[model samples]
Target: MKMRNLPPLNALKMFEAVARNSSFSLAAEELCITHSAVSHQIKLLESWMGVKLLQRHSHGATLTPAGQILFTTCVQLFNSLENCINDIQQKPINHGITLGAPSSFMANWLISRIESFEEKYPEIQIKLMTSNDFKLLENEQIDLQILSLNRQVQLKSDLVKIHLFKDKIGPVLSSEKAHNITQPSDLLTQTLLHTESNKNAWSFWATQHQVKLNEAKNQRYFDHLNLMLEAAANGLGIAIAPEILVEKQILNGQLIAPFGFTDSDAEFTLCLKQNCLKNSNLQTFIEWIQYQVSID
Candidate 1:
């Protein structure tokens, strides 16, 4: 096979960093290199490739059309390399388990309890991947998944599903703002916070309670539930969230669940390949997590 010439690896690395960040200065800061050095390397890369990759403006940089193609390839290449390295590293002892779940659940519930699990089973290492998409489990990228789904939905026959807890959702806001929101109708006068991943959360709650939600009400949306919760705690707006995710905030007096939680059709559930439990480390983690949920 004929070996194809490739761009310098270091320059490619810098290019990926700069393109990913959209700023040479930020890339330099991340890579521990000088701004001028990044510029020089990018220039060298452009010269070697005979095409401009970035357009520098006063604010930062933007990728050229060719740069976009290269960037996409670089991202996939780097990700595959990382997975290869991780697989190689874990092959010997194989005590590591990669668990995927929604960001809100991982941030608000799982992370705090992870320390206890680690203390009890020091030999087991848990790698958490935050994602709302359960389809990731089909790709075999992760060993287990924590999914939030409607109770009425049928489980996939090929996978093992365990009920972790019922998802109880309600409207929450800063305690100071709670007083003004005495009833569900008051929400119409205030800004309603929404999360992109759970777009129907407020609507679902409203439908369940037979509350007429005003479509034209003031509203704000966040990419993740955690961010929306933070905005709510900061008095930005009222947010609908699962009780488990906002329990700490409610207890700390930072937020209040004015409506209190009601059972949603949804529930948090654990999922894994049918045969995954055969792995001793994964089995131990599954047992520990189930016990944790039982006690909680």
Candidate 2:
């Protein structure tokens, strides 16, 4: 994996930017160059290789079959170089730690508490990514990840997982709507709000409370948890949400949980690769997370 025979650095970077973003104009903006300059670089590369690498459409540039092959090779090249640099460094790879978290977790927990982590480790930069699917750790170059383990998750890697905290969830409603939900059976009388995006939520909560859901009675559904919370805040209906995400709202009296319903529910975990589990930089992150969980 010697870099001695590689193509020009500028060309490789331009190719990657366009490939990753799929637009010459976007690549130009990212590289601080003009769109025509990006096109010129691609043209030179195409002439050298004697192939049409990209299919330019009105919307964006898509990789031609040849471009797809080249892009795949470049991604490997970058990953290998990253691994090599990490292995060569004598210290705990501190400059950057790439992270992946659930969108629900990001919107609720991580974003709010991020300033503290940054203040403590200002020298160690972080790149945050979000996905509801926690399985991104299997193939991605993620240093750490967080996920809700309410259900059995399918993943493809051998990982060292640390359980962070269990989510205590119950129905949240506006003060006005709270009147209709006197008991579990009264849930049927109200305008049931839900997140159809999370397939297991409603059914699982129903099973936990020993109640059946008349799906037909559901009045509103949203894809994102934050949106559902907003709807409930506006007196839309009762929303079943984790206490961790809505703690600020609950504390401020914007919402209410009239019935306490956390009855031996499933949990979420904050996990990392075991080999680097004791890395000083990552250890700082782990300690901070554990402190929050402990106090809660």
Candidate 3:
């Protein structure tokens, strides 16, 4: 770091540009200086180092053994400096954030709100993967997850968990299909659509209403809430849906909630490996989610 022992940085930069391009004119063009200025800096660098770095030819220039060594070192040094600057500036140096969640939540909830998040943080690119498997985070395949968990579920203690909100369950049907039913028991005559992931949703709603459901009817089952809600909107049958995921559909008249919603023991939670909490991109996304919840 002693300034007296080092050659001038401007001279070193000029020499590097000349050596890289093998032409003083090209280096001067890149540095926005006259060709004579580039030649003068190169002479200054050689005088300071007491070694001839470039062997000038009639057509161009070539690096001597000493010059080649210096050029290689300069390339690495400049590249490292650029990387440090990028990290300090919070500029993107690699692929952006990656998140994982269940298929239903990804399709029904997060997909709808992602555009606003993108608009707010245009510099950060977000990739969403749908999988029920939590192992992806352990393998470093995903940075974080939006997990839906029942109260009885247990997770590793080291993982950071943030509770966004609890989910509520209710019957959702199309407007035309919902008009026939005046009471809860009237659902006995209609075919019911079921989501395999939330098999207990209807039972929770029925318990809240103090009504028994007729289970003998043939019920159609879907693996995710997105498909079940879509089926209900198409008048396939009345589906036991989560209020949080289907709120927009109900508001748009795509689906109707005949009976009011009831709280379920399940919660919608944000999960990430403890170390990922320090990542700025993930932090921004988590703060956005918190902001959304506050407004709701």
> Judged by lDDT, which candidate is best?
1
Which should have the higher TM-score, number 1 or number 2? 1
Residue range with the least summed lDDT across 10 consecutive positions in model 2: 149-158
TM-score: model 2 vs. ground truth: 0.64
**Residue-by-residue lDDT tens digits, candidate 1, 43-127:** 9999999988888999998765467557655754675576688788885434578788875676578756876887898777766
lDDT of 3 by residue, 32-106 (tens): 999999999999999999988988988878665467557645654665565579899989766577777775665
TM-score of 1: 0.70
Please identify which of the two predictions, 2 or 3, would achieve the higher lDDT against the true structure. 3
Candidate 2 lDDT, 1-296, residue by residue in tens:
76565556677779877876778988999999999999988888887778788879998787654575466456546655756787898545556776777656664666546657777778876656654454656555677888776536544455777777776778888888887677776776677677754556666677777877864366678866766886788887878888787886688677898876573345677667657776777887888888877877
Model 3 misplaced stretches (Cα beyond 4 Å): 1-95, 214-216
Q: Candidate 3 at residue 29, lDDT?
A: 98
